[model samples]
Target: MATAVQKITLSSSRDIPFNKLVLSQSNVRRVKAGLSIEELAEDIARRTLLQSLNVRPVLDADGAETGMFEIPAGGRRYRALQLLVKQKRLAKTAPVPCVVRDPATDILAEDDSLAENVQRASLHPLDQFRAFEALREKGKSEEDIAAAFFTSVNVVKQRLRLASVSPALLDVYADDGMSLEQLMAFTVTADQGRQEQLWQAISDSWQKEPYQIRRMLTEKTVRASDRRAVFVGLDAYEAAGGGVLRDLFQSDDGGWLEDVALLDRLVAENLKTEAETIAAEGWKWIEVAIDFPYGHTRGLCELDGMAADLSAEEQGTIEALKAEYARLEADYDGADELPDEVDRRLGEIETALAAFDDRPVIYQPADIARAGVFVGIDAEGTLLVDRGYIRPEDEVPVAEPEQNSDGEPATVAVDGAQPSAAVVQRAVITIGGQVAEPEDEDDDAVKPLPDRLLTELTAERTLALRDKLAITPSVAFQAVLHKFCLDVFSRYSSYGTAMEISVRSASFPVQAQGLKDTPAAKAIDARHKTWEERLPKDRTDLWDWLTALTGDEQAALFAHCASFGVNALYEKGDRYGGGATPHTVEQRIADADRIASAVDLDMVEAGWRPTVESYLGRVPKRRILEAVREGAGKRAAQLIDHLKKGDMAKEAERLLAETGWLPEPLRMAGVDQTATVDATEPEGDREALPEFLAGDDEESPADDADEPHMIAAE
Candidate 1:
């Protein structure tokens, strides 16, 4: 055990003159990789050299050592140092640290070179990340680190972001508990608590992914590119102390704005400011919203106004631009490609022409006094001002003064007869744009309103009315039953009017924005979803499955399916029609009353509450006040009576939040026949089911006039 042991000898180390070193043919490195020579040279200039070159002394033909030594390894490092010498920053006589092999050693130069290049391990990625963090902590900017390491600035930033993740997760990553991609996901958010929590939540589940982490962290946020954020610029949002969660590792659609509520408030405030500016333009009313639905002014009248006239100089400039544009276009018309200058000149001409079109419109003082304007943001975030809209109630009345030939004021005839015209032709006294039906020449009889137009208007009302009715399943079922009975009985067909009794769920012709988010709408969506899940998927299996349902399930399902068929629409009554006559409408009402009495459908009890979008917003000021007065009492109505319709609607909504007041159209028209019925009677679960399809996933179509159809079990 005490026997002498031989000591291992490593390759000898020595300093070699830069001028004496020359290219070694035994060197294995040839192709460029990692850092290029130029970048490596820059790095060397910044911080001497990281690795020393491996070299051996050159041997002459007689086995004698030559003055110059041939290099065997670390060729890149040699090139970098040589480049420094060429640039005069380093001297040729400067000695570079190197490892030298004994001239008599049996090891080949190529083996030494290969061993120097391959024997060492690459730096661990985590070590690199920590190194970046250490450099940042040591007062070095990311830019400095990137330049010194010969990498991109973004790469430096990404590494810093990775380093900033929670230490606990970082430990897990270091221990190989997660992949690099997953670690990258956690970097989207800076909150250590959130990062740790999300990892813990999904670590055991199969759903743990970087994208999922990002989604969960930003589910409540608005995208930076969202319209609301676009309207409220990101600079303003951040100034308001709102935060944005950005992903440095992946494209996040410009990242998510973390404070949605702040964004909404900013949007509202900015919109209000925009409204104020437009209001100063002498508009009778100004409507401010993020967006106005197409045909938002359906009931409003449009005023005709003239565009402002162009000045003489402006007109002459436009003419000149037009001439230039024409010349450029004509010259390039047949060319395969337009010349850059010609294209640029044509664009200039177009821009000049467009400036003229932006001139203001001229309106009469009277029209301006009564006309309203809509101020909203367009899809591109540009301010949009739509002017010259007149409400129906603002129409002016034609004035007439009464004076007789005897110089005495004449009174209008009480009998509603018109005076004779100058030619003795029968004078027609019509007002309010009501045109009486013309007499048929063949029969010389007064004809009724055109059946097509009447049906169209009735159809409009029927759909709106039906939307309210379909939500009341009890009422819908009974209404359907009433029609079924009428069709079967075939009783008294005499003295009928032209109205239809069809309950085809009429498509909503118009709806207020965000109406689908109301409590009632949400509840309906949830209910519909419940049924959708409960029912069998295949239509062929529906009947068998329905028959197999329990009594309660059957009753609920029946009510739901029947609601689709319940059409309580009031089409215009024709004296001679195919459907709803005046008499038929009366009968339908009587039948609807019976059903309302039997099931006791109270809209207030069916998860419906009045909100601006659902009710108050669409009505006039008078209607809003009336609802508040009835629901929250007169004091509440008085508090907001002085406000404009829009403001009044908002105030009224808050006041009536707990009040179960419904619009007259949505109220049960049937008499209280169920008040005296036995309380023990079974009303089924129709009352519990919501009015529309249920669940957040069940989106109410944006088009209110989407084809009228039921989400039936079939």
Candidate 2:
């Protein structure tokens, strides 16, 4: 009633002489790939034959079996065995395990070879990882595994690391739910729970880039290249029992430091030790910190000191370095490029000469007794010791003249009616129509207005005068320009003009990382340097040099100096809680908008763009979505909104990069908005505006409702 199953005959197995197994032209493999023949031969010598070769009997064209066999499949294995014979590691007559096929079969050798190569499944990565881990658990060292498997120790370690990941994630990896690269990223952290959590979070998101995974895993950790970590050497941190997370798969820039608190402690201890050593040099005090705000020395006085003179031997070394440098330069005078060793030797000479030039400064004992040093680490992780800064309170007080009974200065008379040189000056002082010093008030006479009342009255008059001066554009500009010039050029003057205004370059204590290396910052620095080079070296000559400059030059210099005073950075609420209120902060931003509008400031043109480190990664998920919505449109925002904070931020960065969309603080008020609108509004969605943007309805409150108040403060 049923069709019978036909009985199939299996290929017979037997031992064959290595010398008799000949390569067949019907072999499917041609190009070289994994594991060279030499390495394979070495592997065979260690493990013997793991897989039996497939061999077909050699026929004599008469359809009869010959004494020898030809390999249709496992050609590489045959070659490896032959290589062992050639090396005398194996006997030519040594028996190799193989499956022998009949010479009378209808199957072609090529068909057998193709089927053997194509039908077989290569070992799964997960399986290999587990196998390596199993070997590791059995007391095999990473090196031993590598040696046995013909792989690198790093490869073995990577495989073991992969195996150590969360079993749940491992199942996903085995099912092809994640890429090998993504799995590799999870190895950055050893916490299996965290690995599983991250996988679960991004499992549904469309943005599971490896970098994003690595970022999420190591978000709380500090980069080993961070200044603090660099200062507290990685070796020292490890010695202190602090852990470090390294990414073997990617260039992690020395990887991340897992224990941030421990690192900070080590850095502090190291910094304090350095400060104490510097204190031994007779400095009055040492201010230690990880970093000081820019312009920290603004109000302080820097004492001038002479460099220590070179000793006889030091002087000879300097001459020798200089001579060697000159000889090398002359030897390669016009060569396209110097020889590698010659170039290196020249660099050494230059460095030696520079060391001689950067001699230790010799400060006077009196100066050292009053001045202090600022000890911190620079951006490059080098010890930064800014010495000889004299705080205002530490400056030597100038002796004051004797005051009369009525609090008036008693000027010594040089002659019958003239005052001494101390009292002789260009300007005469008057306060509220009275002399600089008022005569003693009399009880019988009507007392003059109180000093407080006089101050109030003069303040009102000062405001009125300012109003008038502001209307006179030419005079106002001249007055401000004159003040700037005097402040810049009259650093050493004992007396100054009556102007109360000053240009104080603002310092950013809290700024984004890499702010100093931004294009705008670099351009400003280059411009400042150019002007500094053009200016006179001596302060006394500054005024004369300015006077000689043409009108355009003067204006350019004025603008450059004024640019330094611009402060538009967003500060935290109540940064100056006691001194500045929220209203003042809001007004400051309003005024900055005016200035920005006047200059037509565009942050996008200044080379600012949304980057993870600069903005997206630092903000909350809701804010990131909001930024993406505004910059890259709603569709793009929705695309990544479901992602976790870390993944969303990275995707948003890619989406918003070219949109030229800026945050509220960076956008200038009164700037043309057509370009921004066109850039942000998706094509064909321009006319289909959102209700809020179209002014059709009131917008709902944001997830972070406090943002409005925070915005006002910023």
The lDDT leader among the candidates is 2
TM-score for model 1? Answer: 0.58
Best by TM-score: 2
Model 2, range 11-31, lDDT digits (tens) per residue? 899999888889999998989
lDDT, candidate 1, residue 678? 26
Tell me the deviation in Å of residue 463 in model 2: 29
Off by over 4 Å in 2: 1-6, 91-93, 175-179, 197-209, 397-562, 565-626, 640-660, 668-701, 704-714
What CA RMSD would you report for each candidate?
A: 21.8, 14.6
Q: Where does candidate 1 stray beyond 4 Å?
A: 327-336, 397-714
lDDT, each prediction:
0.65, 0.69
**Candidate 1 residue-wise lDDT at 17:** 88
State residue 52's C-alpha deviation in candidate 2, in Å: 2.8
Clash number by candidate, in order: 19, 0
